[model samples]
Structures are given as C-alpha cells and as structure tokens.
Target: MHVPDGFINAPVSAVAGVVAAGAVAVSLKGARRELNERTAPLAGLVAAFIFAVQMLNFPVAAGTSGHLLGGALAAILVGPFTGILCISVVLLMQGILFADGGLTALGVNILDMGVVTSVVAYALFRGLVRVLPRTRRSMTAASFVAALISVPAAAVAFTLMYWIGGTTDIPIGKVFTAMVGVHVLIGIGEAAITALTVGAVVAVRPDLVYGARGLTAPLKLRIDGELVDAPAPAPAREPAAAHRSTKGLWATGLVTALVLAGFVSYYASANPDGLEKVATDQGIDKKAKDHASKDSPLADYGVKDVSNARISGGLAGIIGVGATLVVGSGAFYVVSRRRTDDESVNSDSRRDEKV
Candidate 1:
C-alpha cells in the first residue's frame, strides 16, 4: 500500500526513514552476492514485471481491490536482497514520477511494502521449501503461502506504525481489524499472482529462479551393493546456445511487461486498493495531505491534458516500466560489478601470497 503524506507524524516518519535507509544499505551489500552476469539483468526485468503486474489490480472484496506486492514473486525469482531493491525502485519511481505514493511517506511505504514483505516472505519461503518436497511444484506452493502471509504482515506493520503515529484518533483496534481483514482477502490475490508467476518462470528457466536452485536431487550410484552419492559435476562454461536462450528469455520477459503495462492495464479494476479502502473506512485519511507531485504530468497514472483515459494511462504505465527497468538495471549492474572487482582483487592477493 502506498502511504500518503500526513498519515504518520513527523517524528515517526523520520525514524522510519532512517530505518528504511539502513535496510536499503544492508540490502545493497547483500545484493553484491546475489547479482551477477546471468542474474543481474533478470533482476531488473523482475522489477519491471512487478511494476507492470501491480497496475492490474484485481477485485478482492465488495469495493476493495488488490495487486501484486511482488515481494514473494521477486524473492522466489531472484534473491531476497535484490527483491527488496526491486520493490524499492518501484516505490521510488511511483513516488517521484507517478505521484502515486507520497514523497513524505516514502520511508513508511518502503518499510511496510518493500522491507517487511520481502524479509518475511523470503524467510517463510525458505522454511517451507526445506520442509516440502524439493520440486518446482513445491516452490510454487511455497511462493503462494509466503505471498499470502506477506500481505497481512505488511498490514500488521502499517497498523503498528499508525498506532504510534497515526494523525487521527481512530481506535487502533478498529484500524488493525479492518486493515487485516481487507488485506487477508487481498493476500489471496497476491498468492495466486505469485504462484502463477513463479510456476511460469520455474518452467521456462529454473536456473534463473533463485529459490528453485538446488531443488534437483543429486545423482545416486550403487557401488559394491551400497548406495552412494555420485561425484558432483564440475562447473562448465555456459554454451553459446544457452546464452542465446537467456537473451530470448530476457526479450520475452520485457515484451510481456510492455504488454501488461501498456495495454492490459487499461482494463484493470478501478476500485480502491486494500489500504485505501481501509483508510477511508476507518477515517485514517482524515489528515492525509496531497501528494507533492500531484501536478506532475504523469500524476495519478495519467498523462497531463490527455483526454483519452486509455491512452493517458497506457503512456504513464509504459513510462513507469521503462524508468524502473533503467534505474533498476543500473543499480544491479553496479552491485554486480563491485562483486566482480572484489573477486579479481582477492584472486590477485592470493596469487601474490603464493609468489
């Protein structure tokens, strides 16, 4: 949910800003280990895909709708650290470019949506994968459960934040109950989207899905009438055909994102999302302030002076997807480059020691 400005007080919002910044810093470091030649660009594509899918809000209740939070899907497709970055990039773009999320409440949105969802979902996903059968089906199931829980977890986090710094005097209990209740329905939507997306990726390129990695059981051999693990295969250089396949996958993913955002988004539900519904019902928006970029050309996911609703929204969505891809890819590229540089330095140091 995109928390608008003035929902949280200055002090609590500032503290949340600090916490979000620290989390982003930590994720940047952790992402160095997750991003590389094969996965870095895929991570960027995941961000763009998440941005696109989020535009297609599905009806959850009578008037409330829900969209992909992308935490579980991203974490399953990429890694948790990079997943956090992906969501953060989307949030940042929405705030500054689309005026969808408030600038003042950026930290709150990032903490509630990006950090909490990714961390909780990834941890639960790992646990479930360990317990369930190691198969693509199991990965998809784990993704569903993880995403189902992550939405409510984010709702709980926002409730706690409101309890501490809510501008209105609405009873915390009512807010929590309404928030959790509506979001529980929203979580079902989240779970379905996550499961389908994860399953599709696992089917096409299991190697690209971080959570699907290592699910394949090692080969077994019978020697001297005793079962034994076969020797692990040595790492082999990626063949040119595999490289072409990866390129094909990337092209396909980008095209899919473009289609989803550019055209399909026009038919998405127009109802308010889970958080907006809850806020309006509970008087949480009594003190909500206007977004600073409300006058931006692309504000409210529409182009300025564009009479055609379909065209305006379509252009905005396309712009958002493109901007997110560029910024996300650049960020991941830097992280991946840093990792390569570190490895080169370490190798050099070891060689000098031997000399």
Candidate 2:
C-alpha cells in the first residue's frame, strides 16, 4: 500500500525511514550474490513489469479494487533481496514521478509494500516449496498461497504502524478489521496474478526463476541394490544460441510490459485500491496531506495539459516503464559487476599465492 503523508506521525515515519534504509542497505549486499549476467537484466525487467501490472487494478469488491503488489511474483522470479530492490525502485518512481505515493511517507510505503511483502512471501514460498512436490506446478501453487497471505500481512503491518502513529483517533479495532477484511479479497487477485506470472516464467525459462531453480530432483543411481546420488554434472559452456534465447526472452518481456502499461492500463478499474478504500471508510486519511509532486507534469499518472485521458495516461505509463527499466537495470548492473570484480580479485590473489 502507498501510504500518503499525514497518515503517520513524524516520529513513527522517521523510524520507518531508518528501518527501510537499513533494509535496503542489507538487500544491496545480499543482491550481490543474486544478480548475474543473465538474471541481472531479467531483474530489471521484472521491476518494469511490476510497475506496469500495478497500473491494471482489478475490482475486488463493489467499490474496492486491487493490483499486483509484485512482492511474491518478483521473489519467485528473482531472489528475495533483488525482489525487494525491484519493488523499492517502483515505489520510488511512483512517488517522485507520478505523485502516486507521498514523498514524506516513502519509507512507510517501502516498509509495508516492499519489505514486509517480499520478506514474508519469500519465506513462506520457500517453506511451501520444501513441503510440496518439487515440480513447476508446486512452485506455482506455492506462489499463489504466498501471495495470498502477503497482502493481509501488509495490512497487519500498516495497522500496527497506525496504532503507533495514526494521525486520527479512529478505533484501532475498526481499522484493523476493515483493512484486513478488504485486503483478503484483494489477496485473491494478488495470488492469481502471481501464480499466472510465475507459471509462465517457469514454463519458458525455469533457470531464470530463482524459486524454481533446483526444483527437479537430483539424479539417483542404483548400484549393488542400493540407491545413491549421482555425480554432479560439470559446468558446461553456454552456447551462443542460449545467449540469443535469453535476449529473446528479455525482448519479449519488455514488449509485454510496454503493452500492459501503454495500452491495457486504459481498461483498468477506476475504483480506489484496497488501502485507499479502507482509509476513506475508516477515517484513517483524515489528515492526509497533498503530494509534494502533485503539480508535476506526470502527476496522477497523466501528462500535464493533455486533454485526452487515454493518451495522457498512456504516455505517463510508458515514461514510467522506460525510467524504471533504465534506473533498475543500472542499479542491478552495478551490483552484478561488483560480484564479477570480487571473483576476479580473488582469482588473482589465489594465483599470486601459488606463484
């Protein structure tokens, strides 16, 4: 959920800022192990895809709507550390460029939407995959269940934050009940989106899906009437054709993201999302302040002075996708490069020692 300014008091908001900052710092270090030549670009695309899909809000209740939070989907596709960074990039873009989420409350939104959802969903997903059959179907199912719970988990997180720093005097019980209830309905939509996306990726390039990796059972050999694990296969050199295939997948994903944000987003539901609806209904937004970038050309997901709603929104969406891809890819590329540099340095050190 994109927590706007004035909802949480200054003290709690500052605390959340510190927590979010620390989490991002930790994720950056963890991502060094996750990002690589093939997966780094894919991670960027995942961020852009999540940014696009989030625009297509689906109706959850009569007046409430929900969109893909992308935590579960991202974590399933990439690693959890990278997933957190992906969502953070999207949130940062939306807050600064689109004026969708408040700048002052950026930390709160990142903590709830990025940190809590990704961490909780990935942990649950790992646990479920361990228990369930090790198959693509099981992975997709795990994604569904993980996504289903992540939304409510985020709602609970928000409720706790509000309890501590809510600007209004609304009863804590009412806020929690309403937030969790509506988000439960919203979670179904999240689950469906996550499952379908994860399934699609697993079908095409299971190697690219971090959660799907190692799902296939290890080979076993029966010798002397006893079964034992087979010798691990040596690493093979990647062929040019395989590299071409990765490029093809990346092209396809970028095209899909463009289509979703540029064209399909026009048909998305116009109703307020789960958090907005709950805030309005429960008076949690009584003191909500205007977004700092409300006057930006691309504020509110529309181009300034653009009379055609369709064209304005479409341009904004395209811009957002492009910006997110550039920034995200740049960030991930740096992390991947650092990893490679570290390996090279270690190799040199070892070589020198042998000399």
Task: Identify the runs in model 1 with alpha carbons over 4 angstroms from their true place.
Answer: 214-238
> In model 2, which range of ten residues has the least summed lDDT?
227-236
For candidate 2, the TM-score is 0.94
The per-candidate count of clashes, in order, stands at: 0, 0
TM-score for each model: 0.94, 0.94
lDDT of every model, 2 decimals:
0.88, 0.89
Question: lDDT (0-100) at residue 112 of candidate 2?
Answer: 94
Q: Candidate 2 residues 45-84, lDDT tens each?
A: 9999999999999998999899988888888788899999
Task: Give candidates' CA RMSD values in order.
Answer: 4.3, 4.4
> Which residue pairs in candidate 2 collide?
none
